[model samples]
Target: MNNDKKIRRSRNRLIAGVCAGIAEYFKINPWVIRGLFIILLLIPHIQFVTICIYVVLLAILPAPKGSFFENFRAHFGEQGRAASAEHKQRSTSTSNRRIIKDVREHDIH
Candidate 1:
């Protein structure tokens, strides 16, 4: 028998994987759970409440360990780390440029 503990799925997730996790835990199709959520959203009176519940579940669920994206990144060794570093560098450069531009504009006034 499968373990009863529920963990968020990383493979079949559209958002935070709450529905996928629930489907896996209950041995049901993920699509069915998604469809049920859609139906709940269509109800006028319960739509906001349903969205809130979904958000709560998303926040509460713990992601599965070493799941799909993490495994893929691990398989590529240093590539993921390099990409992350590059992204950080780019963001820092952009912020610096913005600060410099603001300073120049202030000096002009």
Candidate 2:
């Protein structure tokens, strides 16, 4: 077993991914951490402390690699890559035409 695990926020987070990061580090389900948070919050005196801790963890934990949009798009497969390639091909072919719309008199020599 490799022991070089780093606790970073997960991409599959419902919120800030603080709980997910902790769960991942401990090798447990993210729901377990969520459940614990909820349970702690249910207690009268602990609610405020729980919220504070969650906020602190959210601020402290590092985000996962790639932007949120990138991660979200990844779930829909590689359609973006294929579309970008097609767009490039189309753009190049059209750009080759080089339409001279207007001949300007002020030519800088």
Off by over 4 Å in 2: 1-3, 68-109
Q: Candidate 1: which stretches are off by over 4 Å?
A: 1-3, 67-109
Question: Using lDDT as the measure, which candidate wins?
Answer: 2
Task: Residues 1-109, candidate 2: write the lDDT tens digits.
Answer: 2379777788778987889878888888999999999999999999999999989887677677686744775765488888889888988897566788778788688
Error of 1 at 16 (Å): 1.7
How many clashing residue pairs appear in each of the predictions shown? 0, 0
| Residues 1-109 of candidate 1: C-alpha lDDT, one tens digit per residue | 2686656654578987888888988888999999999999999999999999998887676557777655664667588788899988988785556443444334554
lDDT of 1 at 93: 83
Give the whole-model CA lDDT for all candidates, comma-separated: 0.78, 0.82
CA displacement after TM-score superposition, residue 18 of candidate 2 (Å): 1.1
